[model samples]
Target: MAIIYPLQPRLSSTSTKIVIGLIWALAFSLAFPQCYYSVTQHYPPRTICMVNWPDDYGGKHHLTYQIAMIVLIYLLPLLVMLITYSLIGQTLWGSEIPGEASDHYQNQIQAKRKVVKMMIVVVMTFALCWLPYHIYFILGSFNKEIYMQTYIQQVYLAIFWLAMSSTMYNPIIYCCLNQRFRSGFRHAFSWFPFIKVSEEDKMELQHTQTFRMTRSYRTENTKSTVVRHNSTQHDDHTTVKLMKS
Candidate 1:
């Protein structure tokens, strides 16, 4: 007989990534005040600001650009982590249709493929979005002329903030795109007071139950076989005694 495997609950890698990403975010936020102070107070007005005034400007505006850069550098990667995690969970845990085992299995496989494709797209997008800023900054370190342009500074700051906002948007995506994560998060607080058994624990319990059932069945079968053998031997002995009499 073909044994049907029971549906197993999928584990969330998303939770782990979310925790790490949040830690990074908090650290960045905590460091921001000191960074702002150093830029506004300690650095020379020209060093912190756009150097070119009028046509090319640098000063406080430049400082804002730097702050935006710091935030974006931290935020975009965290966002990617979150989005990837959610996608992974969704691909693993989505419901299967009943009465169509093959179709359901095929759907799951397709979902996994789609997740891989999405991951590649996300990685490329991150690279494209952040690479320019990193290159510009590296070049700017050598050439002061880059910092002298007010319009360039504005454009850089805009891109930086746009990238940084990706981090904040992950939570929104989690709520919107992945139903499993959304439901899990929604009910998480409800289980706060109680000790919850993990999915592993539940699986262990199921295996234990199955083992006990198999053991009981085997024992019963063995007892029945022994009883039948004894009865047959007794009947044979009686027939031989009657024939001899």
Candidate 2:
């Protein structure tokens, strides 16, 4: 949405909180029904409460939940990212920013390209990491015998590792690929003896805050101007009505 309307006023903190709260509530409710559906087994050294299957109808509940979640949580978000990033890529590459100076335009283009590239990498990582995990469960749900195979635990372990790696890579990708994020990261660890934060890093951090403040100021000014214009028109209309009477 920000990419679609960059000039529009951003959501306030209250609005952001409300959105976050609503999403959490909705997600919790969706997963609530199957949360308690599980089976427990006791191994020699450990007790495994095999939730999401074995306790209830695995095909009826677990498989359905798996498919639903795969669509809702994984595929839907991936599709959104792909689409939004594609549009953003087109927007960035399609034309020069109107009225921007040549050098500044090129700089802006380069920065935006880095961001888009980062997003694509992030999306690809997410898909690769989670796709197998989803597929594994779907397959196991359909054929329970697969879970009994000797290599099943190993495959599951590998898939779990890969899926978790997705969560850990985004920061690394941002730090490695983008100068701005790297700069901020360096500044964050500047207190450590081994970490060095340069003047440029400080500027990079400040630049983001400055840009946000400037954008907010412009939005407020625009709103105020509109309000004043409306007030002036109303005053003129009142004056005209009195004169006519």
lDDT of each: 0.59, 0.85
Off by over 4 Å in 1: 1-101, 168-245
lDDT per residue for candidate 1 within 1-245, as digits (tens), equals 01121233334699878989998997788656546545232365454532332222344444555456646664666576667556664544564434656875785566455545555555555555666666665566456687678698787887677666544554554545443444555456446766465665555456557867996687678779999999999999999999999
Query: What C-alpha RMSD separates each model from the true structure?
Result: 15.6, 2.8
Q: What's model 1's overall lDDT?
A: 0.59
What value does the lDDT take at residue 86 in candidate 1? 60
Which TM-score value belongs to model 1? 0.38
Q: Residue 229 deviation, candidate 1, in Å?
A: 30
Best by TM-score: 2
What TM-score goes with each of the models?
0.38, 0.84
CA error at residue 201 for candidate 2, angstroms: 1.5
